[model samples]
Target: MAEAFMKPTVILAMTMGLAVSARTVVAQDTERPERGREGVTAPSGGAGSRWGGPGGGQQPWLPPLWTALDANGDGVIDADEIARAPESLKKLDRNRDGRLTMDEAMSPRPGGMRGPGGQGFEAGGPQGQRPDGSRGNERFAPTTRADGTLDLAMLWSQGRAVGTGPVRFSHPPMRLEDIERITPYGLMVGGHVCPIDHGYFYPRPLTPGQPHFDVMSPADGHIVMISHRTQLTGSTEQQRDYDDYALHIEHSATFYTFYDLLTQLDPAIAQQLDDATRDRFARRQMGPPIHVRIPVKAGQVVGKVGGRSLDIAVINTEVKLPGFLTPRLYGHYAWRVHVVDPFDYFDEPLRSPLLKLNTRKVDPPFGKIDYDIDGRLVGNWFREGSGGYPGDGRDPRGYWMGHLAFAYHHVEPSVVIVSVGDFGGQPRQFAVKGNGPDPAKVSAKDGIVKYELVYAPVNSSGEPIELPPHMRGVQGVLLAQVLENRKLTMEVFPGKTAAAVTGFTTGAETYER
Candidate 1:
């Protein structure tokens, strides 16, 4: 028999540090005043009101149902008046029952009271109704009707994942046990798809037209060539270091835009044909065209007109690699480019010996370690930020650190083992540094890494507490010490007074590359 996953249950125990209580559900009807009830007024006063009001009095707070109920137009409400409104009558008779019972009126329909695609309150017995009869803890709760249908308006009002937000693309509600059965390889949430590898390495495939390359040595770095047609390029590197040490590298890239040359290469892109992209390429009316300009070793402008000159470089531009990954670890790497006119380009990982290089181990004089998190060494978190809109003037347009980073092509989700520490610094300040396989020589199928972390909290007294065999409803913090040769005490802040402080640890392994 298939194991049933446990459904998320609302725990209402003082020991659990949750304050939840059952409450009575009630319904009430209000009367409309001639001048509109207090807190109810026209959006605009007097003549500005588009629709005429009762006796020329604007009624702003009148809900559509209430408006429909006010059939007599006396600017007052009563049972007779409500009965006269057909729409209100239909709404009140939710089950189509002759009379409106308290249960029928209060119970939400399968589709919910909100419109289509709306999010509604969680369905079940009413819980957590305040003395004033308001709901709390609704943020994490699903908005649903009593019958389990979602409220379309509420869902839409919650907003869709537009640019970027956590929880976007998250899996729908499922029982904890069922999650494993349905998503054996993990699940995709918030636009991120996490496939389960169960501690295996699987490389992604390279797109067409891109060549394979490798890193022969650290000094003999690979060269990246870019052209108008080449939008993106990606490479992977893996290495193994026995001793743990922090690594940092400085890098830069140059971008070239041919304002005048683009005008001549493709007149359509040069002149904006549509008002929408008037400042962009002329092909704005038609779809933008892709133009590739390969630079020769030596070149001079053969023709000059309209203040336009065409010049290309052996290597168009460069960008620095942020923090390094641990050695022997295989992870996907790629560079993406967005062309102004033509389609975007992705320089897929190359699988060629020409780009391959053996990494040379270098030993830099150790700098004095200043920061350290005093705790059992468990795991670490490192990230090379990616996938975000270009920075604007106010904010540096680039990926923000701490956004969950993973490869899209990989068949399995990338495991990230984060070591919780008490070092009270900005989160995501740690780095992973090491060498790995030459990206040019390895295929996407060969670059993969698996990692996971388990955290246990310790009490404020620096004593480890045994958590209940089965515990829930606890939140805490972890700190780390980053500076070399420095010991720093870290603390975990568990909201539960009786919560245990069990240390946590994470395990990770690299593959292929």
Candidate 2:
């Protein structure tokens, strides 16, 4: 299974280290005459060192065979040439699959260089032994014919037997398991957010032709919004620069935001897409998040972007408030707290299982599980419903109200709003209580779990002089759940309702455990 998951040898070599290709080696040799390749013409430099070094049975032995397979006389042997060539098909296609896959083509045959009887150089039967009863581990020169040069017969014989036993490769397909193994919290390979040629600072101007990296959905979810060509042109920066392509997957528990995609369109095709589907694409460009809720499997190609540099932010909208909040006795003051790192939940392997567990025995097993909220509330938490912000609706521009930290113990739980440059001042907490019939029970059933939480008007103090009415005293009903045992997604609706489903939400909150 491990071998089945590995990538092709050449790609594995390239990514594993700085193994140059045959063309690359030749180009380098051209510049530095001293490092010229004499008879060694195979892909045999940095990569060979990974196994045992070129001199120690790692040398590229089949020059003539390589040349023959490379129909265009190119240094590399591509899949097309291998498929068309009858010699390669007969000798390499071990399973008779007709088409040549990378693994089948690179796997070793029972006999070396020669078919069973043809004599060029003979290695032991899959045990790395030479015909002379010596171990093939020690490098031995290939025997030449009476003419003292290699011929087609000898080349075919030796090439057929060569095997890559020691060189194991690993480039797993980007499935949920593979992705979790590689980057549980999602990857930060691309640099921080980029706003085109604009300076590297907050509130940079947006531009078209910005680069976006191609990505598959990490899990099953709907494609709620996709922004291309860069601007919504609304009143605020949140509206103007709020352009970002996003995938809402995993039951809306997680969403991936792709920023700074390039302005390239897909190639002209024989068939055109539907109007509604084509409309989602920015700049009339083809590809990606084309439709809502198109169920895609792990590692399936959703779309590609034009840029090499990509910024993918995974926002887990599931947030849970800490349990054990006790009333305070001392003076209350705002305390600045850091937002929880998005990837921190991944550190706890128990929070997420690596493999799928057997759920056949448990009826309706994998939906929303009862979440135990038992940790400190000290990480970033975003209020749903702002463009580029969590939640829904198209609010113009608003303050970033960075990550929040709520200390529930201090008199009236202190709240801290993260800001730019300088630290924020003190914070004031809001009223949060269980919405159970008893109003004291901390836990509730899976469906219709309710929470009574009040919205405040000021940033740090209860004294509200004057501010936007939107920030005024507001009371609402909450639809809450501990989703996937990792975080919570709660939808706040106006008025105290008891239904399992709701029409719309005034606000939303995702708290990570």
Candidate 3:
């Protein structure tokens, strides 16, 4: 499966909803302790509360176990529920020490590797039970009865350290050196670049004439190119078409800040602080920052250049930032490169020439072409917005503009290497080699070549943050479709088989290429 990566906005948005739901559940539990009493420990087998059984005892207040074990309302703790319990608790109490009090638990001495309790043993139970059970200070035996209860017993035995697996690539890692630039040879059409922080950077100095940019596979494989001609023309009929090909494009953006005037003045010390300090103080008074994930929708269409319609599919939609208080936010200025397959075409006419371009220009024939480049602003999200405050509505002027690049893939002899950027300007590089379709099966340490690069936050002076496992990668299949009205939706997944993006109008010609 191709690794898939998304802007932080999506991650923030998904996590926000989860955080809110979690807090809500916590609040509900606190408000109604007895609300789920029947499910935790029921009396006898008559659907008794989890705490009411003979082996269990009921507590007046909702026991922490109640909240921990009651994943579903259908009461009665099950094996799955028990398994979900904190690993710390299960490993420390070999004797099933009903409670994990600080004293009863083992502690790692000052400079010792093991805390009060030996490593892993801190959760209770025996240490290890391999063939040579005499490895560590703890031994564990899985208990099973006809009734199907899973319990562990602690036995004094030696424990061996767990074996480590080979490192693997979660996604195809790329660096600037791997990216190859394609010099534009076509007419300069209308185009826009919006970088999140710094604006556009052309290879050669910009002059009066139109400048074109393109990207080719650095590894000398298939080349995908998107071009736009610069000319003043009428609004030509928008055509939607697709071809089985990998698409690549560069984007640019500029960063700008928008202030929230409502939260500017402080009533208590009306004239105490200067304008700038007062502005800062007012922002501080808000709440923590909120991040939102804006979902990108895809669409499709099939028709001749002058005659075409669109069909759209809202693959995914999410808000990366919730409303919050913050001064300056940082995020990616992105341009989407959509790979599509041409199916068919339709006949259509220009809607508005001024808004579009050249309404009366001759239509081009459709076939398995590499690219048809276009430009527009997708969406934006605030990273660490409001500097960590709530109820503050200060959104910066976010734009998308950047250079374009492309990559190629082939299955003939199973060899893939970047062929373009190694000799010129900064380019991103990635390598993937494996015996089977599953890229994850390819160990990161062997049969693979990868690169790592650091990206500084949009507007921060601090050191760059190392990308975590979740944030550092993406894996998935890329799919695009053209819908009625020139709409297009592009779908990206973590692996070959993963869920599709949900929400957003992706199939409109307004956004698709």
Q: Quick one: best TM-score, which candidate?
A: 2
What TM-score does candidate 2 reach? 0.24
lDDT tens digits, residues 1-513, model 3?
A: 011212333422332343233222221212112212211332111111111111011121122223223333122444454455454233333356454443223231211223114443233323322222112111122222222221211110011111221111111111112212111111111121111111111122223553222211111111011111111111111432211111111110110001111111113222422342233234331111111111111111111111111111000001111111111121000101111111111112212211122111122211111222222111211111121111011111111111211111211112222211111222222222231222222222232212222122211111235656754443332232333332233322323322344322342112221
* Clash count in backbone of candidate 2: 32
Q: For every model shown, what is its TM-score relative to the native structure? A: 0.16, 0.24, 0.15
lDDT of 3: 0.20
Q: Which regions of candidate 1 are displaced past 4 Å?
A: 1-278, 281-291, 294-427, 431-513
User: 1-513, model 2: which lDDT tens digit per residue?
Assistant: 223223334333432232132123121212111111122223432111111100001223222224234433222344555454455334334466555454444332224334223332233132443332222111222232332222211111222232211111111112232221211111001111101111000112224854333344444333322323333311122333322332322223222222233233222210133332344343332121221223344434455433222223232223312321210100010000101122332333522442232111122211111112333222223333221211111221212232232222111123221111001211223334431232123233443455444543332212344646764443444454544433445554444534534633555566443
- Give the least accurate 10-residue stretch of model 3, judged by summed lDDT: 308-317
True-vs-predicted CA distance for residue 397, candidate 3, Å: 19
State the displacement of the C-alpha of residue 109, model 3, in Å, after optimal TM-score superposition: 64
The list of candidate 3 runs beyond 4 A from truth reads: 1-195, 199-283, 286-474, 481-489, 497-513
User: What's each prediction's clash count?
Assistant: 76, 32, 160
What TM-score does model 1 achieve against the real structure?
A: 0.16
In terms of lDDT, the best-performing candidate is 2
